[model samples]
Target: MTANRVLYLLGSAAPPVLNIAGVIERAQAADWDVCLGLTPTAARWLDDELPALEELTGHPVRSQYKLPREPDVWPPADVAVVAPATFNTINQWALGITDKFVVGFVAEAIGKGIPIVTMPCVNAAYVRHTQFDASIATLRVMGVHVLYGDGGFVPNEPGQGRPNGYPWHLALDAATSALTRRDAGRE
Candidate 1:
């Protein structure tokens, strides 16, 4: 199979970031060219990891607004995944507020009608918050896929039910399923 171009959007949450690098590695092995989108808040966790990501993906990580003087080369993304999406970022994107580079890219993707999957990493409290709920609802109405978060096995806790974490492999499956469904409808 040809490598699919996937854009990996990293949020500022801990568990999500914890698995991203490994996910990138897996994607690379599968021949997918992964593009990294790091939020400004996420940059705090990216010390040596940023360059390592570039090395792993063979494409520069795009976290800032400034592009190179000359047009830099990058593979067109086949799909985009925002793993560990923050409540603020999700709300902002859903409400059309692209204040930062990462959110801006996601906004542009939505505008262009590209395939986007957001795996949110939110506390149990915020997940039930009104604004968060509304934002996700608006996003779904606008055709964005929100991977439902749930903590498997555990009945209740803060940040319990997320589609990410140790079950990172499931993410690829979830993304594939969404893309397949989207493409099938188009056909």
Candidate 2:
């Protein structure tokens, strides 16, 4: 576990984001103090379940930046996992665009030396876009553990996404490995 054991479990508006509750539960089972954050679209998708998610995590499900002078809602994170990271999120994050709360936090986290794990849920069609590969490479070069392609999330054909088959465990395992690596570096 990380020194803080605080996990910022951020998700984007992919189909896999719908099963986030179960992922949160699994993270909790691993003894992580999970803080949930969502992209705006993802937040809207889970609007009705936001309260329950907040209750489950014992922290707010923040999708927007807090106003200046407002107290921060979630605890500081020891590690961050961006699963089902949408195509937009991946590109924006790599380009240092932090308009959205979830992307903002993770982008800043990189400079703060917070270990991060991200798995993109982009469809094969979207992966063909020119920016996608560059973005993915940029993130990896920044020391983010990107679980993509083989040994991680492989994009399915467009319109053929299987929400349940997004390989949640790989992202969780990558998070665990990231924390472990951080701890080892300290020793």
lDDT of 2: 0.94
Best by TM-score: 2
Residue pairs in candidate 1 whose N, alpha carbon or C atoms collide under 3 angstroms: 149-161, 150-161, 151-160, 151-161
Q: Tens digits of per-residue lDDT for model 1 on 11-123? A: 54445675677888786776667777778767657756878777877777776776568574566666677766777888888888987777777788877777777766667
Candidate 2 residue-wise lDDT, 37-142, digit = tens: 9999999999999999999899999999999999988788889999889999999999999999999999999999999999999999999999999999999999
lDDT of every predicted structure (CA atoms): 0.69, 0.94
TM-score of every prediction relative to native? 0.81, 0.97
Q: Model 1, which residues run further than 4 Å from truth?
A: 1-4, 67-73, 150-167, 182-187
Clashes of 1: 4
Best by lDDT: 2
